[model samples]
Target: MQNQLIAFEGFDRVLNYGLDRLRCPSPVGVDRRIRLTQKVASIEHINATMFRVVLDSAIWIEDEDKPAIIASLIAQLHAAPDTT
Candidate 1:
């Protein structure tokens, strides 16, 4: 995963992007918005039913809107076409 510092939620957050599905730990914590389909590199695999998206625990503890984030994630995952 490549780490890049991006401004989010009025703070500089270290956002990791690449093929890795795991969210990298950042000092400022991760925002749930960054975990969307565009940012998640393994999204195609997940959408194809080849695997699943794993979220780091920090998101649960840090993101203020975890429930909605989780819900959106789940909906996106389930909305994918079943390849298996």
Candidate 2:
């Protein structure tokens, strides 16, 4: 049912951010229940079937370092997981 609903969890967090029910981007539906302990931000649910997740804060890399840092992140995303 997870692929049906919407949720995001990572980095030692049991549940970081998610929508209990998709309610079409409204003040009545938007809520922030997750608390992050590091540089990651909680997901922002914008609509009934839409979400925004910011993986990292700007603290890790400077303005000039963003290119390299972004490239590294992209490579990791496209890279295969390690079994060993």
Query: Which residue pairs show backbone clashes in model 2?
Result: none
Which 10-residue window of candidate 1 scores lowest in summed lDDT? 67-76
Kindly report which residue stretches of model 2 are placed more than 4 angstroms away from their true locations once superposed: 1-39, 57-84
Q: Where does candidate 1 clash, by residue pair?
A: none
| Model 1's TM-score against the true structure | 0.18
lDDT of 1 by residue, 1-84 (tens): 112321123222222232323443343344434433223322334433334443332233335444222211211233334457
Error of 2 at 39 (Å): 5.6
Cα lDDT tens digits for candidate 2, 61-80 = 22222221210010011222
Which candidate number has the best lDDT?
1
lDDT of all the models against the reference?
A: 0.31, 0.29
RMSD of each: 14.2, 17.6
